[model samples]
Target: MIEILDPAQLPRARAVGALVATILQTAKARCQVGTNLLDIDAWTRSMIEDAGAESCYVDYAPSFGRGPFGHYICTSVNDAVLHGLPHDYAVVDGDLVTLDLAVSLDGVVADSAVSFVVGQGRPEDTAMITATREALAAGIAAARPGARVGDLSHAIGTVLRAAGYPVNTEFGGHGVGSTMHQDPHVPNDGRPGRGFKLRPGLLLALEPWVMADTATLVTDADGWTLRSATGARTAHSEHTVAITRDGAEVLTLPPAA
Candidate 1:
């Protein structure tokens, strides 16, 4: 369902956005070489509980995924990209990790994701992460009151293609408001003038992700983690944005250090 949040609801939306951002940032900070993936999930749970926010992931049963995600956060490592279920694994130096999170506070929801190297960074991995981040920025910049969803998708696709990465259309951004995922599916690539028109109070989670080599994906035995078909490394970046008269307001920016 598409939800145009009321002005009064925007504040609650912002609060939930802030909470999700802070939790992701905190998880990123705690991630290091030898850190267990389960630990990261635990940390996320504690933070959300402390803030009195509900996890939009845990217990989440969507048709695309196995029922009940049963985790507080998504910890994608190396070849893993989306729906990465936390498991018994420890991060190592040079590992590229993506953390995706969504939470509800005061009855509003926000979602965001970030990809970064765990310890000593690999140049190629760093470049991939940068590309996704740039693409996400481009997508958000295209999210204006009069712009179409395709404009945002085109902007994102342009950045990724310019960076020499193949775009995947299966999973992309989507409308977000009272629910984690809603109508107006925002693909990573599309015609600029086509698709749903943007309006004030529309909230969208724009994500851009790419694999180092192939665009194809393979599901892990766990039935949740999605990895590159060729075991190529991947990176993902995302943000929850609100369309307004002025432009897009990014609600999931990490808190200032």
Candidate 2:
């Protein structure tokens, strides 16, 4: 279902977006070396509860994943990319971790993700993270009224390809409203001037993720975590954007310190 928030609801959307962004930033800061994945999940839960917000992922039962995600946040490390279920693992130095989070505040939902290295950052891993972040920015910049969804995808794709990374479309961005995932699927790559046209008040979660070597993905035994087929490092970056009259407003920015 595609949901377009009324102008009055936009404030609630912004509130929810801020909450998600704040939690993600806090979780990213706490992802130090030797940090357990479960700990991050727990911390996220506490933050969500303290804010009187609801987690979009806790009882999420999507077909692509195992029913009931049962986690407060998605902790994707190293080769793992999407739908990373938190497990009993400690991050080590040089490990690339991706934190994806979604939450609802005042009945509006916002989703975002960030990928970074733990202790000592590696050149290649850092490059991959930068590429995904750049791609995400490109997508957001393309999200304006009258622009087609393909325009956003193409803008995002151009950057990833220029960075020499393969774009995976199996799982990309989606419309976000009262629920987590909604209609108007946004791929990482597509032709411009095609697909759904953007409209004011529309909310879209634009995510761009890339694997180092292959576009193929393998599901871990846990039936949720997605890893690169070649076991190469990966990175993902995302933001929830609201379509506006003049341009797109990125709602998932972290609160100013």
Candidate 3:
């Protein structure tokens, strides 16, 4: 389902977006060497509860994933990329971790993700994370009224390809509003001007992720975490954006310190 927010709903959307962003930032800061993945999930839950916001993930049963995610946040470590279910695991130095989160505030929803090294950053891992971040930025810049969804996809794909990372089409960005995922699937790679046309009040979560070696993915025994087929490292970055008259407004930006 595609949802367009009315002017009155924008404020709620902004609030949810801010909350999601702040939670991700705080979780990232707390993730260090030896930190348990479950701890991260707990932190996310506390933050959401304290804000009186609802988690869009917990109890989320989608066809693509196993029923009831049963977690407050997605803690994707090392080779893991999407739908990473938090388990009994401790982060180590140089481990690339991706945290994806979505929450509802005042009946509006926003989703975002971020990837970074746990402790001492690896040069290659850092580069991969930077590429995804840049790709996300490009995608957001293309999200303007009258622009095609393909334009955003193309912009995101261009950055990943230029960075020498293969693009995966299976999972990508999507419409987000009252629900976490909605219609108008936004692929990471597509021809410009060839898909759904953007309109004012349209909210989209654009994410760009890539494996260091292969584009293929393998599911973990847990049935949720998706890891790279070759065990190569990976990175992911995402942001929630709202189309407007002049351009796109990034609702899930990190709060000013």
Candidate 4:
């Protein structure tokens, strides 16, 4: 179900968004070459409790995934892109890591993800990460009120395809507010002027991801994990936005950082 928050609920939405953003940013800053995946999960747990928020992932069980995600954050490295379930592993220099986070505060939810190299990384990996960010921005730009879902998808797809990257849209963005994933699935590529029309008070999360070589995907042995189809590097970037009467407002930007 798609939710359109009234002014009263928008504040809670903003609070949830800020919490998600700050936690992810703080965790991203602490990740290093020697960081342990479990440690990262612990840190995320601490932050979520400190804020009196609930993790959208900890007990998450979707038909597509193994029951109970059991992790506070998604730690995707190199070949792992989406649905990355953290495991017992130590990050190595130049390892590409993507942190996907979602939290609910005061009955509202916000979700976002960021991809970055652990340390000094290969140029190709660096470029791929940047491309995902660029595509994310384009998608948000197309999320204004009166715009169609396909418009946003098309905007993101244009950027990724132009950069010579493959978009595996099996998993993309979706309606977000009282819950994590809602109706109106936002694909990474589509024809413009199609699909759900954007309306005021609607909240949507737009994410754009790309694999270096192929547009297919493979789930890992863990069942909750998703990796690049061709074992190629992948990157993802996302943001939670609210559709305003005039346009779109990104509710997840942390304080200037």
lDDT per residue for candidate 4 within 1-257, as digits (tens), equals 88888988988988888888899899999999899988999999999999999999989999999879999999999999998998999999989999999999998989999999988989999889888889888998888888999999999999999999977778999999888999899999999999999998899989999889999889998998898878998999999999998788898886683
Top lDDT: which candidate number?
2
What is the C-alpha lDDT profile of model 1 across 41-97, one tens digit per residue? 999999999999899988899887776999999999999999999999999988999
- Output the lDDT of residue 51, model 2: 100
Estimate, for each residue in 81-199, the C-alpha lDDT of model 3 and write its tens digit: 99899998999888889999999888889999999887788899989999999999899888898999999999999999999999998999999988899989999988999899999
Tens digits of lDDT, candidate 2, 169-236: 87899999999999899999999999999999999999999999999999998889999999999999
- In terms of lDDT, the poorest run of 10 residues in model 1 is 58-67
Q: In what order do the candidates fall by lDDT, top score first?
A: 2, 1, 3, 4
Model 3 CA deviation exceeding 4 Å by range = none
Q: Tell me each candidate's TM-score.
A: 0.99, 0.99, 0.98, 0.98
Cα lDDT for residue 119, candidate 4? 82
TM-score of 1: 0.99
* All-Cα superposition RMSD per candidate: 0.7, 0.7, 0.8, 0.8
